[model samples]
Structures are given as C-alpha cells and as structure tokens.
Target: MTRYLYKELHLAASPISWWFLAGALMTLLPGYPILVGSFFICFGVFQSFQHARESNDVLYSVLLPVKKRDYVTAKYLYTVFMQMIGWVLCAVLTVLRMTALSGLMPYVGNALMNPSPLYLGFVLLIFTAFNVLFLGGFFRTAYKFGLPFLRFGIAALLLISIAEVLHHLPGLGFLNTTTGERLGLQFAILGGCALIYALCTLLSLRASQKRFEMLDL
Candidate 1:
C-alpha cells in the first residue's frame, strides 16, 4: 500500500509541491521552527487531496485489488512520513540559515536552535494533530471543499490558540534552555509528544477505515 500510495498520491503531487516551495520564505523569515516544519507538511497534505480529487482517485483506487483498510493505512503512513521529512528538512534549513548569517541572525538562531524538546515537541504535536484532523475529514469525504475547508479552519484556530497560550506561559523558560540544562523536562516533553502522535495516528487510521468503507465508490 505504501508503494501504491506513492504512485497514486505523492507522485501526482510532485508538481504542486513547487508552488509550496515557492513560498518557503513565509516559513523561514519568521524564525519559527514549527512554521518551517509546517511548510512542507501543509503543501503535501493539501496537494494529496487536490490531486486525489482532480484524478477521481476513489474510483481508481476501488478498481485496484487493495483492501480499504490497507488503503487507509497507506495514506496515513504516507502523511506521517511526509511530516517527519518536513520536520527534518526544516531543521536542516534552519541550521544552514543560521550558519550562513551567523552574525546577522545570531539571536534568531540561538532561540530556535536551543534544542529543547518543548519547541521540537510542539512542532511534532501540531503536525500530528493536523494530520489526525485532516485525514479524518479527507478520507471520509475525499476533497469535498466545504468539509475540508471547515475542518481546516477549525484545526487552524485551535492550534494557533494553543500556541498563543503556550507562548505566554512561564513554563516556556524551560524550553529556552539547552537540552543539557534540563534533561528531565526535555525527556518528558518528547515522550509526551511521541505518545500523543501515536494515539492520534491510530485514531485517524481507524476513522478513515470506517469512513471509507461506508462510501459508495
């Protein structure tokens, strides 16, 4: 199913990826690592759905021999894979940009590259949360513009609100420190994010399986 999804979705989304890449500065200039991580992820998720709709993918996928459950699994796994890639790529770019403009953006680099799990974990959680919400809506209805848009708006609002609240929290001081300075906090943050990511992934897969099974095509 992974191979099949790569053929059906990501392969087709390749062209659209460039449009997202074109706006890379939107994520970079802000010096927010998660926004950078979200850059590739948002594009991948949106393009997959866009291509799926443009291609009448449901009908084509049904014609294949794969089981519906495997289809859901493949789609979610692919999304998670892309999100991880996005995170790593953004992290690398952040490091490179910091090095290239070390004198100009030392503060920006120091803040982002602080290496506490709080920031990294927050990024992971946001991406994972978006996936669960998006896949739940997308698999159920494919690319129905209304449902996807509505769910996306809701997800965006909630996530942004959480970030805003977190930004003002005193606990963020721990996140400001280097990993060596607060190993226990970093461990907890990473562990919690991983646990939540796993749960959300499983839930999204199950929801997709249930929703897709009920669809006529």
Candidate 2:
C-alpha cells in the first residue's frame, strides 16, 4: 500500500496538481474568499484523476499483484496527503494573520472571512464534500469523471459562498475575527469539522473499494 501510494505521488499524479497547492497563499488576501483555496486544491486532485482515466491508470493498476482494495486506499491516501499539505499552509498563514499581521490595516478592517479557525473548519468541510461526492462518484464507473467533478465543483462553490457570508449574519460575526475572538468556540467548530472530514472520507473509501472490486476491468 505504501509503495502504491508512493507511485501515486511520483507517477500517477498530474504535474500541475502540485502547483495548485499554491492556492493556499490566498489566505493572505484581505476581503477575498480565501476558502477558494480549498476548491482549487480539490480541482488539482480532480486533474490527477482525469489523467489517470485518460492513461488507463486503473486498468494498469489492477494488473499489478495487489489487492483491489489497495488501489482505493492509495488514491484516498494521496488525496488526503494533498489536502493536509494545503491545510498546513492555511494554518501557518492563519497564525501569521492572528499574530504578527493581525494589526495591519487591511486585514484588521477586512469585512470578509479572515484566516481563522472557522475558516479552516470551512476548508475541511469543502474537502469533505469533494471526497464524498467526487471521489466516491468516480469509482461507480471508474471511467466517467466529468459529471462527478462537476457536482463537486458546484458543492465546493456553495460551501465557499456560505463560509464567506456566515460571519455577516446576525450574532455569528466572530467567525471573521483576526484576533481569534471566541477562541474556544472556533476550536470546537474546527474539531467538529475535522471529525466530519475523517468519517466521511473513510466511508467514501470503503464505498469506492467495493465499487472497484465489482468492476469488470
């Protein structure tokens, strides 16, 4: 499984996918929807899946002396790996926004979402939607991805829009704070989002494996 995942990163993945991780830098922008970074990261993963489909990677993969389930495991692990890298980047940027750069005029006065724990929670939710909808949909045919990814794109956009506007709603304004206001609630939201992400991804992995196993390939 480890070796297959290594192959996924070094060989099966599209080269441009790594470049999309740079979207994490969007966290530095004031008054913009930084959660779009999460969308871009998922788009990057989609491209890798597209590449795999075009190259018949799944057909080739099954030819190897490995368990059918391991193929799904490798893909899920690789996607999680990429998501974590983007998450870490956002986390570091959030720390900067909360500490050294907190007082900057633009960030201080920004009315849009700040790089707060609430923001990270939304990021995780965006990732969760992608994994459950897009990745799970892929294995249903293992050959059709366009519709699955399109569904994920729409879902991610909705998540990003909601995240951007949540803080503007009455009584929930602390979500955009740069100083980590309501720190305990923010962490609680983040923890809950993390749990949702884990459970949904694991369930999606199991479903994908089952679908792949029944594939006639």
Q: Please give the distance, in angstroms, between residue 47's alpha carbon in candidate 2 and its true position after superposition.
A: 1.1
Off by over 4 Å in 2: none
Query: Which lDDT tens digits does candidate 1 get at residues 101-159?
Result: 43565345344334334545666776776677667777766656456646755665566
Candidate achieving the largest TM-score: 2
Local accuracy of candidate 2 as per-residue lDDT tens digits, 22-136: 9899999987888998899888888898887778788778778989878888899999999999999999998998899988998877878888888899999999999999999
Kindly report which residue stretches of model 1 are placed more than 4 angstroms away from their true locations once superposed: 9-14, 18-40, 93-116, 164-167
lDDT of 2: 0.88
Error of 1 at 92 (Å): 3.4
lDDT of candidate model 1 versus the reference = 0.61
